[model samples]
Target: MENKTRTLYMIPYIGWIILFVVAPIALVVYYSFFDIHGNFTVGNYGKFFTPVYLKMAISSFWYAFLITIISLAAAYPTAYLLTKTKHKQLWLLLIIVPSWVNLLLKAYAFIGIFGAHGAANQFLDIIGIGTKQLLFTDFSFVFVSVYIFIPFMILPIFNALDNLNPSLLDATKDLGASKWTTFRRVILPLTLNGVKSGIQVVFIPSLSLFMLTRLIAGNRVITLGTAIEQHFLVTQDWGMGSTIAVFLIIAMFLIMALTGFRRRGA
Candidate 1:
């Protein structure tokens, strides 16, 4: 009866995974072998290897890398500071509150903030920087992407720091290790898994960001996500879209494999 009950509980979870995850991926793979006219062809896969697609892939990777790096740079310090705060949970909650808002809403809010004659430009003018076009630029895209992803990056790192053993720090100090030395040799290595987890969350989504490229970047930037959207929605080319998605899925899996840390025991 216990075994039957366990199987019953798993049925829904397994079914959901099959329906939402496995099925969609299988369909994408299937469609990737076809042409726009629904004819079976491997040409879509070949097309992805072309210079245009290759460049788009590289550009997508570069943007994702930049977002991940900047988020880490900002988040690690912020997270470490949060760990030192008396009201760390409250502060962390406040930092994360902005992320609770819908991404579309946040993106639109930035549109107003970064628009010409917008708050950003107005502030620039006041500071003698003068108003400049902020919206629909690489800067805006990267800035907004970083802002959106920072909370996610911080949360994991904060958890890592919060859960760290205090005795280790004391032992380090007893051994005459300086703050920087302790951090470099001990703290960082221990928290490295959390950093990897943060990177996994931030970098993967950054690779497939389409809306930000449109509204914030004014379509000036083309990531794999934007290309996939264009092929699927604008050009009505499911085969190519699926092909791009397949490669993206492969990339996502590769990242997951790299970022995933093994537990101490089986």
Candidate 2:
């Protein structure tokens, strides 16, 4: 009777994962390797290997890498400092609060700041320089993504850095290492796990980001997300949409696997 009761309690958690996470993945797997007219078709997967799809996948990774590197470089130090603070809880809140902002809203807000008539351009014009259209460019998308994911990177790094052994640095210093040498040899190596966790956590979904690329970047940047949206809504092509979705999943999984390997290596 007690075992049955315990099993029942666990069932809810297991069922929830199955219900939400597993089921959708199964559906994607089914669709990705099959056809559209409600039949089995490998053509979708076949078509996915073409140059255009490859280019999009490459482009997505290209941007994703940019954002990940930028976010990590910026967030790691902030997280390290916050984690080491006497008033750690307060500083952690400061790092986290921006993450609670609506993603779309934040993207849109970037539009207000980076658009041709936006504050940045206005400042440039004031300096007697010709204004550049910052919005709707690839740089804009990357810049905005870095901004959005900054907090995600920070939180993980803070968790890892917060739990870090400060005394380990003291030991390294006592062994006749300069501060930079100790930081390079000890602190960085110790913090690698957090950095790995943060990069994986930030890059995967950030690549799927449609709104940020769409609004700030216009349609010039067609992510797998935007392509899927186009097939479904604009072209009414569910098969192609599903195909793009499958590609996205594969690409994301590859990135995640790389992340996992890197984490283990770290």
Candidate 3:
């Protein structure tokens, strides 16, 4: 009876996945192979290998890599510090509060901050430093991407650090191991799962960020997500767009596998 109840509870979730997740993927696969007229061809897939598309693919991965590294570097320490704080939950709530706001709104907010006559440049001008073009640059793009996604990175690492055994730290210290050595050999290894989870959450979304790239980078930075948007909406090339979508899906799966999210012995 308990097993049957558990199975019943899973039915709705299973149905939801099939209806939303599986169906959409199947549609994308279908569209990828068929033109607007419904004729089948592999040309759409071949187009991904073209120089422009290839460059976008490389650029997307490169930017995503940089964002992941930066987020990890920043989040790990922040999470560790939070663990040591008396008001850890409050601090975490503050960190996550911005994420509750819509991403598009956040991007637009940054646009004002980074705009030429905006806060960043204006502050520079006040300090006797000349204004610089802060928006529509690689630095701006990566900075915004990191800002948007760093919370996702931090939460997982925080959970990991919070759940870590304090006795291990005491054991390491009692053995005459320094703080850095204890962290490197003991603390880091234990919390690696959280780091992996954070990477999966942050890096995959970073690769396919379209709105922030447009608002912040202003066409100066092109990514795979931008290509998909162009092909789907601007160019009206559904087949090509679906092909890139399929490629992105595959790339996300590869990332998950590499990050140890994939199940073993399955």
| Tens-digit lDDT string for candidate 3 (19-56) | 99999999999899977676899988888899999999
Worst 10 residues of 2 by lDDT: 257-266
The clash count of every prediction, one per candidate, is 0, 1, 0
CA shift at 30, candidate 3, in angstroms? Answer: 1.2
Evaluated at residue 260, the lDDT of candidate 3 is: 76
lDDT of 1 by residue, 1-266 (tens): 99999999999999999999999999999999999899999999999999999999999999999999999999999999999999999999999999999999999999999999799999999999899999998999999999999999999999998899999999999999999999998899889888999999999999999999999999998999998998888999999999999999999999988788455332
Candidates arranged by TM-score, highest first: 1, 3, 2
Better of 2 and 3 by lDDT: 3
Query: How many Å off is the CA of 40 in candidate 2?
Result: 2.8
lDDT for predicted candidate 2 compared with the true structure: 0.80
Q: Candidate 2's error at 91, in angstroms?
A: 2.6
Best by lDDT: 1
Candidate ranking under lDDT, highest first, comes to: 1, 3, 2
Q: TM-score of the candidate numbered 3?
A: 0.95
Residue 210 shift from truth in candidate 1, angstroms: 0.6
Give stretches of model 1 more than 4 Å off: 1-5, 261-266
Q: How much RMSD separates candidate 3 from the native structure?
A: 2.1
